[model samples]
Each structure stands twice: as structure tokens, then as C-alpha cells.
Target chain A: MSGAVPWNEARAQEIIDAHLGLEGPALPILHAIQEEFGYVPEAVVPQMAQSLNISRAEMHGVVTFYHDFRHAPAGRHVLKLCRAESCQSMGSEKIAKDFLERIKLEWGGTANDGSLTVEAVYCLGLCAHSPGALYDGEPIGRVDGEILDELASEAQKS
Target chain B: MTKIYVPRDMAALAVGAKRVLAAIEKEASARGETIQIIRNGSRGLLWLEPLVEVETPEGRIGYGNVKPSDVPSLFDAGFLKGGAHPLSIGKVEDHPYWAKQTRVTFERVGIIDPVNLDDYVAHGGGQGLAKAFEIGPAKVIEEVTKSGLRGRGGAGFPAGIKWKTVADAPADRRYVVTNADEGDSGTFADRMVMEGDPFVLIEGMTICGYAIGASKGFIYLRAEYPQCAEVLTEALEAARKAGWLGENVRGSGFAFDIELRIGAGAYVCGEETSLLESLEGHRGIVRAKPPLPAHVGFMGRPTVVNNVLTLATAPAILAKGGEFYASFGVGRSRGTMPLQIAGNVKYGGLYETPFGLTLGEIVNDIGGGTLTGRPVRAVQCGGPLGAYVPPSLFDTPFDYEAFQKHDSLIGHGGLVVFDDTVDMMQMARFGMEFCAIESCGKCTPCRIGSTRGVETIDKIVEGVDVEANIELLSDLCNTMKFGSLCALGGFAPYPVESALRHYPEDFRKATLPAAAE
Candidate 1:
């Protein structure tokens, strides 16, 4: 009912039922759950499995298999850094390493203050402007340390 | 009223197009001038993004790399009247990057309002469908076959042959599936088509449906492209409202409707069988082929799975006839390929050119060399699964066959350039690491072999048993190449092998023994 839907059995069931009629509803249903609850709560999986007429193992497998599905709530701002070939050519590896070391966090680790979570994305399709990063799902191109630091500080403020 | 065009393509938006659009609006309001603002798709020349165009007496006069702050200045210079300004790049089509391009598929991209059905119709949109209806299904397949159009999603299988097989195959139900899960690193052409000119994809898919006797269609889109998904949904709704799609499309009595299925961040899903598996609500795992998707696909019914470009180009092939389309290409690679130049290149963008141009021309001449102004070292053609080409082999023609001869591939036509500063060993390790990370665990060689590859490369980097480890890595690559079920593992060796062969110096330096030192 609130802006960020809290973990509720009724809400999860509603989301699962909304997509159950589709041909392949597992991924879509999972995506909808994440969209609604910020993350796919472990509690919601069983409910979704039950509604879809599949076992809990099958539902859990689908959830864990894809990289986009978050098992836990991400920080207020999620930073998806591109570590693929195009980005690497423009010094993304160093940028990623330096940023992680600066924040004292590793890949997929949220900052202690809950301001940021850094995840490695294969590519953002912004190859022309390499060393790209997505700040809260909006892409930022030609990324460097200064830009990343500014973004992190801004995220902390928000 | 003066009409101004600003791209809503994600790449353009990434570089402050929204800000520029707002600024233009604000500046216009202040001057009390009435102007029509059109949100079009990008022209694919990404280096000069936020490119704003104004309809002037001369033509659509262009301004490159316009920022929010420049809007007021542009207004002051009477840019609406095509007055000279510092940012003016003249007409967009006259730009050298655009002029030379043979834009068959991308003719309408960045030029028209993406969702405007009227604009699409005005610019040779429905002609393909009209032509397809006139020729009938069998003749449509013949036209596509004669055009020599191949799958643009890396594998250069002829599109017509695939369609013919699906058409001839006896099935109770058939479906047309577009592989819009474009997860390749240096590729964005599919995204461009889906966002900028979504109706073209719709038209192409609908034509495919008519040709193959399919009544249902689906676009297996990636989740990363939220903009494309939104635009495509809007476009599909509009097409349905206009009777272009639904139970009876364009009064032809051919019942066909398309559904959009979003993928949850799996690169392997770009593979056809894996895509079908994902479409069916299962894990995005590779399936062993022999019964290709054309024969047994999408709920075990015959399905025609095609890339966005391959489908989008269908309209032109139908409208202009197959021979006209086939006349542009060299060798077996017919029609124009949208070569996406990316990474450290100066003029990194999409260039749709005919095959037969040497790789050197694409990199040195058209690309204008590295962005760092350093000597070019390596270029990775195609996606992550493609080979790393050294400067020595830059002369190889931009053809599928030519790249194959050099143990490389033009997978999806994405060229990622690297300067001399790149460490080949690091790049090679990344290839194995990426494979390990994205492998679906469907095949043992892909899942385990990729992990072993990463470990072996790490050992090589750590100078552990140097020569023996290299030998082991090669052996592992061979096993994966021969034993793997899909291209995910089979072609993973391309980057590793190419990197090692081309830049042995980097490997030797990383793994040199202390005794040798």
C-alpha cells in the first residue's frame, strides 16, 4: 500500500496472479515482484511457486539463475558498472578496482551506510562512450574516478 | 512553425539530450516563439550526440554536441532561420560519417518521430507489407531468399533458407520470434531499431508471419533495454489500434499478434534455443540442436527466430525486390551490415556499409583511429565470444568468410577497438572470466571448462608453471570448442586463442619465470 511495498503475502500473491496466464510467466513474475518490493524476498518465492503450480526448487532455480534478480534489497542507489570488453578498453577495470577499494567494498557489496551498491554489468550498450556506469538505472557514459566519487557522494546525500 | 528534432534514443539521452530539449523549450518560451518539437531516434553517429536538427529552407540543418547552456546562444544566433552558428555541422546527411553509409535498414532512424505511424507510412514503411500482400507467401519467401539476407545476429545463416524451411515444415501452429535479447558488449543496433523505428521491426515481423503461416509472434527482449521495451509496447499498441496488427491485419484477413517477453539479464538467452527456453518460463539454458528452432521451437511448434536487424530489413527486401537488396554486398555476405564501431575509437558509431571493405579501412580511416591518440593495438570484432584481432591482421576484409579464415568472426558486426595501453593477458583472462560468469551450466564444457579456463589463466598470470599452464589452457579451449553444445562455449575460445596467438608478448611477460628474469 505504501510507496515501497513491504513484504506481504497478499501483495506477492496478487503480483504472481497478475502474470500467471502468460505463456512463460516465471521471469516476468519475478521481475514484477522485484519491481514492487525492491528485491525478491525469499518468502515470496514459495508463494509464487504455489501459484504457478511449480515446486519451490524450480522457482528458486529461476530466481538464482538470472543475474538481474536481487536476493536482498539493494542500497538506495545502485551503481551497475560495465566491465566488458568495450568498457575495459577505456580503463573501466582500473576505475572499478579503484572505486571498490576507495569504498572498501567488493563487487555486489552495498556500502556500509546503505548509500550505494556496486554491481558488475556485462555491457550497458553505451559502447561509443565506454567506461559507462548506470546510476540508479540511468546510464552515465565516459565514467572516471572523479565522476564516480561525485555520484557516490550525491547518492549518500539522497 | 519551425520544427526541431532531438533524439530520444538512450545513447543520446545519456549525453544530455533531455537537458538540451528542456533548454530549447525554455529559450523558445522566453522569446515567445511557437515551434514544433519532435522527439526522434538517434542518427547513430554517437560521437556528436545530443545532435539537434532544425528544418530550414536549405534542409534539416544540424548542430552537433549541443548542451543545455548552448540553447540560449543558439537562439540568439537565429538558428531557427538556419543562421550560421559555431555548433552548426550543416545538414546531417551531408556529414561524411552519414553520407557514405548505405542506410537500407536505418533509413528512417533518427529522421522521423519514432512512434508516429503517419510519419512511418510517409517514409516507405507499409510498402513492404503492401508488396508482401501482393506477392503472396511463397513469392515473399522467394524474394527474401533471392536477396541473400543472412542472420545478422553473428551467425550468417541465410534468412530466406531459414524462412523457407519454416514455411514448408508442417505444423499445427507456427510462431515468429525476434531475438531482441542483444546482450553483446559492443552492440546497440538492435536497441536502436527497437527504440528509434519500432514499427519497422513490427512490419518486418508481420511480413515474416505472413510468409511462414504464423499467427503469433513474440520479441524476446532483454531487461537492460527498458527504453526499447517501453517504446516497442507503445508502438505495438498503436499498430493494433490502426489495424496493422491483431485478428485481421491491414484487412488481409491474416490473424497475427505479437507479445513482448522480457529476459532477466542472461547473455546466453541471445542464443536461439536458449531464448526459446527462456520464452517458455524455464532457465535460460542452451539446448542441443539438430531440430533447430525452425522445425521444433516455441512450445515445440515450428518457429522462425530472427535478429532485429534481419527482421527489420525484411520490409526493404520485399518492397525493393530481392535482387536490388542483394546487389550491395560482397561474397556470401549480401546486403548492408550495420557495423557498430565502439571502444577507444574516435568516431565510434554505427556505420552500415557493404561487405568487402578491409578492417583497416573501418578502423583507421572511418574510425579515425584511437580516441587516446595512441597507436592502435587490438580490435575485438563481434561480441564477447568473438576473436581479438591484432594490428597485423587489420587488412582482413569485413566479410564473414574472411574473418573465419583468421579464426575470428564478425559476430553481430560489433568492432571494439583498443589502444596500445591494453594488456592482452588481462583481456584474455576477461574472455574466460566473462564466459564463466555468464555460462548457463547446461553443458559441462561451458560451465566447468569456463571455470577451469579462468583458473588456468589466473595461474598463467601468476607465473605458475607458465608453459604447461598455457598448454593446459589451449587443451581446455579445444575441449570446449569440440565438446560444447552451443556457441556460448564453442566460440568462447576465440577471444582466448586470438589474444594468445596475436599478443604472445603480453602472455610471456606476465608468466615469465623468476629464473628467466
Candidate 2:
């Protein structure tokens, strides 16, 4: 688990206000809020709903529907392992299994020290160099267990 | 000062292009040599990246698979003067992979500075929009129709017909939306276009807007391509400043502008309706289509929704006249398709060719067969939803109709090869599993049937009533195919069915008696 920051209403309002005038601003607002705080704070949902003139249920639904928007803050580093067919053809499953075992974490699990979060992404569009991964938004291609271990160790150090 | 070119494409960056650039910069500074380093886009020859190029009197000299450490040696070997080295690949265009390609949409991708408007114009960018303005909207539509250009996205719907419908529709507020949500695993053509030559996309969209009388356009880009989004944003700004994209574009009094919208990770959103839904700030759920996007789309107005390639191909069609593009291809598929060759292949990259090459040619001659050095077992043409064609069917031509004859699709023209080491049963299971994971949960057949398909495949793999489970899986696939809302569920059966039909031996392994085993 990652450390949580207390929700700040003013910051949420600022994010909402910035995107309020745009056509269909709900997704952008949520994205901005997440970018700023690392996750969509629960308290900000109703504020967003009211600003967008939609129901709280609708706002929550929007946030929950997209896999990219997180309800909670991620660990220090997020490692997205591509689980799509291209990566699978290049032996991503074995790499994924070995990395999970080495880190003592399952898919979508955070490390015990909260230094790393592992998630399954459909594709990173790096199929030409398969077994792709994204470590903190930087794509790593032809990934192996050793590479995953190196990334994990670096995250721990950070 | 000598000019050096290195790609800033994500794939290039992935394989240490940044480090290569840094090394070159450091070496130059240390030697007190002034060399202009230009960050270009990948030439789609991914195996040779980070490929460095130098402009010479003999034309551009190329080096491939260069490393940061190789930079000092490269300098020592007089690479600045285009001297021969171990990594020297000569002229990049002379490479067989590049030479064979029919690069219409991607002509300017690796050659020009991506964000520079003047560079784009110099490389024959605004000619299409200019031609569209000269001939007017109806002629533009007629020319596109004459070109026989179909949607480069999966469906193969005729592009001109879709435009004509939107153009004919009476609406106060019409819109053009580009589906840049390239979620297919073996595809990166859209990403390359946006990052490498964004103005082409802009030009294409502007042409669409002009033809359809639409004032606003939006590119719904996937969130994974942050770099592409940045490049596009910068390009949009540059284009606006240069009077190519803003109000009164090209001083023709045709006001049109594009806004960039980002998608929050959903594979099904690649489907047009779901893309529209996501664009409207909602969950990317599939919508039933009696009222197609062409008739009624995007906030309940007549809108033209096209894939990135479909739109990007427009500039060429308008510039050279539609008949010129139509002349290149075979059968119903006109012009060239950008084929993304990947997975377990020796020479994996983008290969744009006319629609007549046999699969054998692509896999053996072009790709040089499997990277694992094993005999080729199967090749999955298109994306995850596409069929896994057996080696026996390698004679099938690389065209839409030819692929359809094999009960497969030429979706986004993505080809992922598999060596003999692959297990077809596991691959089938993965198809169901991927569908289950990414289904939008709108229709029951897709959301529920996919999960059931996985369970049935599991039973087959476990040898628990294997034959019975196979029948059940087949039945489930049929239900999903007919009953699902969109291609996400409808085409999910292609891979599963193809795998089972082609490689029955892999599936039968679990069913062998214990003693026989």
C-alpha cells in the first residue's frame, strides 16, 4: 500500500475549475486530479459531480469504468507488464510469473515495502520488441526476469 | 556543422536512443566539434534502431542497432564524414525491407522534423487540403469514392461512402473524430504517425472537415502514448502559428481546428461507438447501431469517425488524385496497407505493401522467418480478435477479401508470428481470457460469454470431458459472435476457432490416456 495524502478541497476545486468550461470535461478533470494527487480522492467525486451537473453515481461510475484512473495512490513506482498476445508469444507469462514470485506479489499487488506496484496492461504497443513493460511511464522492451528485478531494486532504493 | 539524425520514436527511446543521443552530444562537445543532432522518428525498421543517419554528398548514410558506447568508436571511425564502420548500413532506403514498402501515408514519417510546420509543407503536406479547396467538397467525396479507399481500421467499410452520408446529412453542428486508440497488440502505426508526422493527421482531418462541412475535429488518443500526445500538441501549436490549422485555415475562410482528447485505457474503446462515448466523458461502453455514427454521432450530430490511418491516407488521395491511390492495390482493398510485423519474428517492423503479397512472402522473404530459429507454426494476422492462420494457409494473399476467405480479418494489418514451440490450446485460452478482461460489459454475450469461453477452454486443457468442452466452447463462440454488440465480442472467436481448427494436436494432448502419456 502507498501512503495516502489527505484530500484537499481547494486543490480539487482548482482542478475542476480549470477544466469546467471545456466540452465534456469529466474525464479531463479526473485525469488532472489523478495526475496531481496520484489517485482520485473519494471526497472529490461529489464536488466533480456537482460541477459537471451529473449525479454522484454517474461520476463514480466514470472514475471506476476506466482502468487507468485509480481509486487509491499507487506505490513509489508502477510497473505495467504487457499481457497481450504479442508479449505472450515472446514468453511474457514466464517472466511475469517469475517476477511476481521474486517480489512476493501477484498481479495488481504492491510490494510489501510499498516501493513498487505491478499491474497488467493489455499492450504497450511495443510488440516488435516483445515482452514489454512500462516502469513509471518509460517503456522497457524485451523485458526479462532480470530486468524486472533490476527495476524493483531501483524502486526500493528510491 | 555536420547533420546527424536519430529517432525520438518511443520504440527507439525504448531501445536506448536517448543514451545514444547523449553519447553523441558528449563526444562532439569533448572534441569541440559542432554537429547538429536532429531528433527524427523511426523509419519502421525497428530491428536497426536506434538507427543513426548522416547527410552526405552521396545521400544519407545509415548505421543500425547503435549503442551509447559505439558513439565514441563511431566518431573515431570518422562517422561524421559518413566513413564506413562495422555498424554501417549504407543508405536506409536501400534496405530490402524499406525499398519494398509502398509508403504513401508514412512517406514523411522518418524523413522530416516532426514538429516543424515548414518542414511538413516542404515535404508536400498541404497539397491535399489545397486540392480539396480547389475542387470543393462534392468533388472531394467523388474523388475519394473513385479511389476505392476503405477504412484501414478493421471493418473495411468504404471511406467515401461514410463521408458522403455525413456530408449529405443535415446538421447544424457536424464533427470529425479520429480514433487514435490503437489498442491492438501487434500494431503501432497510429503511434508512429502521430509522433513522427502529426501534420499529416491534421491535414487528413482538415480534409475530412472541409468535405463534410464540419468546423470542429477531435483526435481521441490513447493515454499510453503520452509522447505522441505531446508531439501532436506541439505540432498543433506550430500548425496554428503557420496558418495551417487555426481559424481561416490557409486563408481559404474555412474555419476548422482540432482538439486532442486522451483515452483512459480501454481496448474496446477502439470500437467507434465506444470511442465516441469515451469522447463524451463517459465509460467506453458499446452502443447498439441502427443509427450509425455516419448518420448520427458525437453528441447526437452527424459525425465522421475514422481510424488514424484512414484519415492519414486522405492527404495522399487528394494530392495525387484518388485514381492514383486506387491504381496500386488488388481486389476490393485499394492502395497500400501498413503491415506491422511482430512477435517471434527475425525482422519485426512495419512493412507497408500493396494487397497482393502472399503470407509466405511476408513471413519467409520479408520477415526472414521466426526469430527463435524454429520452423514457423502459425501467424496471427490482425490483432487478438484476428485468426491464427496455419502455415498451410501461407498462400493467402495479403488482402481484405483473401483474408475473409480464410475466415480471418486483415485488421489494422498487424501480423504476429508464432514458432512451433507455441501451444495453440493455450493461445486459444488467451484469446478468450483477453476478451473477458477487456469486454465493456455492455452486452451479455460478450461480457458473460467470454468468461464462459475461458472456463470451457480450461476444462478442455484439464482433460475433463475434453470433447464435450470443445463443443461447448464452439457453441459459446457462436453465441458471442452473433449476439455481442460489437467486434470486440463478435470477432473474439476468430483466434479461438482458427487455433482449434489448425492445431488440433495441441488441444488433444490433455485427452490422451494416462498410460499412453
Candidate 3:
């Protein structure tokens, strides 16, 4: 109740409930556990290995296999600037560079202040906004230096 | 007693739906108004998102893109009593956009509270499943096949054919994997449908299981989509609780179950084979084709790997009958697609129309042109991997064949519009760089070629060996296309090539010859 939704007991049951006695139910079960808890915590990995009757290495392999699962806590805001073709076409390289420099963060990294995490997302479905970006999860288009500045300010207020 | 539906999907929230929800709740109580509000999905009318549908005796009246302050005036206008507000498109059901769209797949999306199962059921959430129980599995597959529903997730593979193959495959354990890893730039239709009508996805997979004689399913959703995943997990549990899923679904002597599989963070995993590999506890890398998942996939068993929209469309295909779906399209592509319209445009959002609508109509008519109010430059159909089309191809229809004729494909139905200010060279480089970063490092072409492609383009941008560097970059993109094992490496060059061809001036202008400069 207090923290990152606890990767503990309730999550353990969610994992247990994710599978049946069928062949190779480990993957689906791991996915379910991670869904309940944002990440497949180091603590839960061992628990899942035991519950799914697989090795911890196997569980770790799974935890690393797909790109959707994450281990670290997301910053209060996840600022995904489109590093895709269209966005990059309209000076996204500069925008991304600016974002990295301004926030003092690299791609796939969070700002030390924990206010923002900058990730290089491919696209936010706003090609017209060439150089698009998503603040938290909402997609915004036509992102220029000015727009980025406005977004940076917006994120700070939240 | 007034009933209202507010969209609680993350998109609506990002645009201040949270504050609006509180306003509606607080104001209704303050005015001592009796209001029953349900949070549904967007009406694809995103310009008017946080779209509030107040129920009337005939149907729900629309009022939205609302702000917290707008609630006072809206209340005064008898909005709490489902009266016509300024934003109200009286008799919301009759709106041309909604009326024209034969939304069998997305029927439950904008109508009911996404997280509320009671609302979902009341709106006929599991009706297909109920009907599925009465008919045999073969009959269900027959209906889907008759519908001519192609996979909406980029590749226009025949959905019925895929199901029939999996259904008839000789395997002890068949698996059904829904590729919900929607990483396309302009494509939120997958996420929107998943978050709005999760039960449709559940019912779809269950029906898929019954069709393929598989007992289990996995929805390999992207991790970035936390909200969608959360709702899906809840819906999965809800389905199990309500006997819509779990052992012997519908007590029809057929057992099937589904679980949400969260992908770590790979865009290439959106590909079916890579998705299958990722689901099977390996790096989200693309697997070789020919053994095509249908014959052998997801743990060396027969598996049906499909897109989220493809699976979501199944329930309706069964409920309304396949012929009903097949009648709507222009060419080989049939049925309605949830077109995700985003970016610099006045009218940006989802438009669920039948296939065959021209790119011109979608961009100029529905999108209301560019947000900058300038003449539109180019529209990128599909995600990063899709092709870029110039204004010349604006008149082309949106079906797979039509797009393919234009050297494009409607990948995931995300149409991103750009104005005159865009440069094509940088866009081309991004295709290479993105593939480079997202590549699983399995093969050389995609893995190394992408990095080189980025470096080569960087040289051009920096005005170093301009023309030669451009040729080298183009050559590298071509090699990556033919030589790479998968589309991650192969098809990435599509955007790069198309950009270079359509807007040659953009690249030449930025990286002009030293003599020209």
C-alpha cells in the first residue's frame, strides 16, 4: 500500500493464478506476475522460478526477453521523445540532444531529480507532429524547441 | 436520474480528463444532481476527448473535450439531465463519423465504462461467447473465414486462414498469442481497443482457443502501456470470475484460459515470430519464417500469432456473421479498421471507418488538415517501419492492396500528418537509427547496418562528403533490406528509400555540395 504496489504476497498469488498444469505455462505466468507488479522484482524472480517449476535463470531469461517489462521505477513522468524517422526528419536529433542535455540524462535514463525519465520511443502515431513526444503517456505532435520547453515546464508542475 | 459516460483511457487523462472527472463528480453532487457516470473509451473524436456522453431516453447526447470549469455551464445547460450543450452533437449515435463506421469489433469501446464489467455485459460484451457456446468450433472458424478479416497489425495476413491452419494443426498443445505490442508512432488503435473493450479481446482469444483446440492464450502487451496492461489484467481476472474464461468456458465442455504477458521493452517484438520468441522466455528477437508459427510456434507447438486488433475483431465476426463484416471493404481488405489519427492536425483522434476511404479524405476531411494550418507535406502511414507518402498519393484508398500499389501499407492504422516544415533526410536516418537501436542484434544487416546507417547520415547532416555519404547510406539501407533475416532489418529501409525518393530536396538542401554552398 505504501510503495511501488508491492511485489510481494498479493503478486505471488497473481503468479500462482496465472497458469495451469499445462506444458510451458511459465511464460504466461511470469507475464501475469509482472503485470500485477510493474516489474519482475529481484525478489519475485526467485518466487516465480519456484512456482513455475523452472530455474531462476530461465525466469531471468524471460524477464529480459520481452521489452515491455521493466525493473527500475519509472520517474514520476516518462518523457518519450520520438527518435523515429519522421520526428528525426524535423530536427528530432537536435530536440533529443537538447532534451538529454537539458535534463542531464541519456536515452533510457531518468533525470537524477526523479522528475523525468527520457526514453527514445520510436513514434507516438503523430507523424505530422514530425518530432513528436509523449509526456507521461499522452502523445503530442509538432514538438519544437518551444514545445519541448513548454512540456518540460508542464512536467515540473505535475 | 442522468447517466453519463466519461472516457478514463490514459489518452483522455493526459489531456486533463482526471480534473474533468473530479469536476463532474463534485459539481453533480454540489447541484444535488443525480448522475450515473461511466468512464468509457474515446469516441475517436479526440479533438473532443474527455467526451462525456449523457444518457437520454433515446440515446446518449455528447458534450465534451470538457474542462473542469466547463462543468458549471454544462450543468446550467441541463447537461446533468442529458440536455443539448454547445458541444452536444444531439443524438450522439447519429454523428456521421460514428454512423458510417460499422464498428463490430469496437462496439463496446465508446459505449461502456472500460473497467466496469457490468456496463460491458449490459452492452452485450460476451454475447459472442454466449453464441459461440451454442455453435461448434468449426462453425465459428467458418464464420471468421467468411468475414475475410485480414490482420490489422501491419501484415495483411488472412485471419481466417491463420485460424484454420492453427485449428487444424496436429499439435498436442496449441498456443494463441495476441501481439498487443503496439509500438507504431501514430498507432494507438490497438491500445485504445484493448483498454476500452478488454472483454472483446478475452472473448476473441477464447474463441480462438476453441477454434484451434488450444486450452490457453497469451496477450504479449508492451510494458510502456501500464494502464492498458492493468485494465487487461483486471479484465482477465473478471473473465475468469464470470466463467467467461477458465476451465470449460461457458460450461460447453471446452476448456480455455488466457493470461497477460508483459513484454520488457522491444519494438521489434511486435513482429509475430519475435513475439513468439519473447513469449517463450528468450530475447525478443525475430525468428526465421517458413515454419511460420502456425505449424510450429510458442514452445514448439502450433500457435496462432495475431495482432491485438485482429483478435479483438473476432467476437464481432462471430456475433454479426462474417458476411456482415466482408461487405464493408473495397478490395481484398474487408471490415472496419480503427484509424488512429494523431499529430499536427485540427481533428486528431481515432476514426473507425471501413477500408477504402482515400488518404485525402482521412487527412484533409477528417483530420481538418495540419495543426499549423499550413499545406500538408507528407503523411506517414503505419508506424516507424511504414512508408511515407507525398501529397501526390493522397487520392489513394486505404486498403492493403491500394497502399501496396503506392509502395505503402496501412500498418496498425496510425496516420501521422506532417506539414511543410518537415525534412525527409533526417526522417530517413531515423528509420535506420531506430531499427539499429531496437534490433535484437541477432543478424548483421539490421544490427550493424543500422548503426552505420546512422553514422553515414550523421556525416551528411554535418556536411561531410555529402553526396558520397548519401549514396553509401542508401546502399547500406538496401543491403539491410535484402540481407537481414527479418523485417526489423529488412523493411526498415522502406521509409528511408521512400523519403529519399519523394522528398529528395530535403536531403540535398541540408547536405548540399561544397561547391553549391
Query: Given candidate 2, what's the lDDT at residue B198?
Result: 94
| Candidate 2 residue runs with Cα over 4 Å from true position | A1-6, B514-517
Badly placed stretches (over 4 Å) of model 1 are: A1-3, B511-517
Give the candidate order by descending lDDT. 1, 2, 3
Judging by DockQ against the true structure, name the best candidate. Answer: 1
Write model 1 residue lDDT over B1-517, tens digit each, in one string.
Answer: 9999998888888788989999999999999999999999989999999899999888898898999999999998999987789999988889999999999999899999999999999998999999999989999999999999999999999999999999999999999999999988999999998889999999999999999999999999988787788899999999999999999999999999999988988999999999999998888888889899999999999999999999999999999999999999898989899999999999999999899899999999999999999999999999999999988998899999999999999999999999999999888888988999999998899999999998998888887888999999999999999999999999999999998898887877754556586
Highest lDDT: which candidate?
1
Query: What are the candidates' individual DockQ scores?
Result: 0.81, 0.78, 0.34
- lDDT tens digits, residues A39-109, model 3? 56777777777776679898787677555456766666777787765455456778779757876778878
Please list the C-alpha lDDT of all candidates, in the order they appear: 0.91, 0.90, 0.78
Q: Cα RMSDs of all predictions?
A: 1.5, 1.4, 4.0
Model 3: docking quality category: acceptable
Assess candidate 2 and give its lDDT: 0.90
lDDT of 2 at B213: 95
